[model samples]
Target: MDAEQQYHTVLAIAGFDGSGGAGIPADIKTISALGCYATSVLTALPVQNTLGVQALHAIPPEVVVKQLDALLTDIPPQAIKMGMVHTKAIVSALTKRLEAHTKVSLVLDPVMVSSSGHQLMEKSAIQAMITKLFPLTHILTPNLDEASLLAKMPIKTIDDMLQAGQKIKDLGCQSVLLKGGHLKGNTLTTIYFASDGQQHTYSFPKIETPNAHGTGCTLSSAIAAYLARGENELSAITKAQHYVYQALLQGKDVAIGKGKGPLNHFFDPEKTIKRKAESGKQGN
Candidate 1:
């Protein structure tokens, strides 16, 4: 096969959201919409919808490892996006499997809670994630609430976000994208702190809408998609944010459920992107 015929591949490791508004489903939509082939490994099963999470069933560590092994061996991804790792065992399993894939760009959305206020991660797993997965992460995308929890500090303002981002970055990730969607005001600011001591702040008008389900998953997956297409970290994040913003704007008026609705992932979908496959590799 011609190298140019190969599609850029992105793998999403996340929980299963039956509602299709979040988790692996949202990741797939976001990745595919951004013109990348999407692969996934389920980490947990959360029984919930746009309303809230009711119950959860985490995948066993061994099974999760087997899934990772199968995908990593057969369909090696150029980039990876991880969400909803609910247990310390799963975190450890992921770290062990991913340690060798240092070349792959990894976007970790430290999903700790749902939009409806349900805890998605086990408290004990926080430390494990910081110690094990953070180092392997190319970019850690955490919202205000999750950042506060990880940094063990309050983040009510941009200054607080900057301080918390530094604290999280010190935990060993290559970079941190601190999302400030929860901050009060008409303008939303997200800060990106790079490993080289560079910081970029992105501010945009807040779109007032209740249909924001799966936003974090979408943004992180979009970032992974852009990275798979060979974009630099800053470029990837900038494009991903634009994608999410447009999705939210396009889907704002549309209603899906009684509770919060989801973004229009297919608002302006792009065809699958093709790239030259690296020699000896399936996709890149």
Candidate 2:
């Protein structure tokens, strides 16, 4: 193997969305876009589109376990990302597999609900996730909707975002990035709270568009890919946000479906490569 080859990897444990807007395919695209090798273990199959999810079928836990076992037996990932685990069985299976391989960072995208008023995760699965998976997560990224659900309060203001960030951090997550895209504002304020007793608030002028369906999946997966490439936690989160912001900005006018569409995760790969080189130079 060439020692200089940048082959960082992120393994995504997520569902399959045929629409390509979110889930396993989105994870693959985001990780690959950020210069990381993408791998996956599908947890569910959701019949979804830009409009809404029509149906969902969770994959059997044993099959999910077998896939993880096979993957972990061969190669290891630098980071692992969790998305759309809709069952307690899946929660338990993933937790067991992840606990066995403890070296990688885990980015948990708590996808309990969708933008279309669909309950993606079962109520029974919530406890399993909190008890088993939350402790394993290195970074938890939840949108304003999901954060409100986890924090057990309505999150509508910037102060609400900060309070919710603290509440989520107490739930065994080492760090939390409370996403503010769902909030009402011209500028989105992403709140990043770490275990280091410091907070980082990043603001981006909101892009007005309906083509932001898979932003959560893209953001978390991008962060995982950046972390896999040896970026610090906070830096990875910030860079991933920038990448997604750009992707959404460029994808706003794209008409992929009749409703809210996805981000252009592969919008500018050449530019990303150039930026990576520039950052590498700066680091040296």
lDDT minimum window of 10 residues, candidate 1: 275-284
lDDT at position 258, candidate 1: 82
Give me the overall lDDT of model 1: 0.93
The parts of candidate 1 lying over 4 Å away from their true place are 1-4, 282-284
In candidate 2, what are the lDDT values of residues 106-145, reduced to their tens digit?
A: 9999999888989999888998898899999899999988
Name the runs in model 2 displaced over 4 angstroms.
Answer: 1-6, 270-284
Worst 10 residues of 2 by lDDT: 275-284
Against the reference, the lDDT scores of all candidates come to: 0.93, 0.87
lDDT of 1 by residue, 1-284 (tens): 67555788999999998888899999999999999999999999999888888999979999999999898888889899999898999999899889999999999999999888888898889999999999999899999999999999999999999999999999999999999999999998999999799999999999988899999999999999999999999999999999999999999999888888889999999999877666787533
**In model 2, which residue pairs have backbone atoms overlapping below 3 Å?**
none
- How many backbone collisions does model 1 have? 0
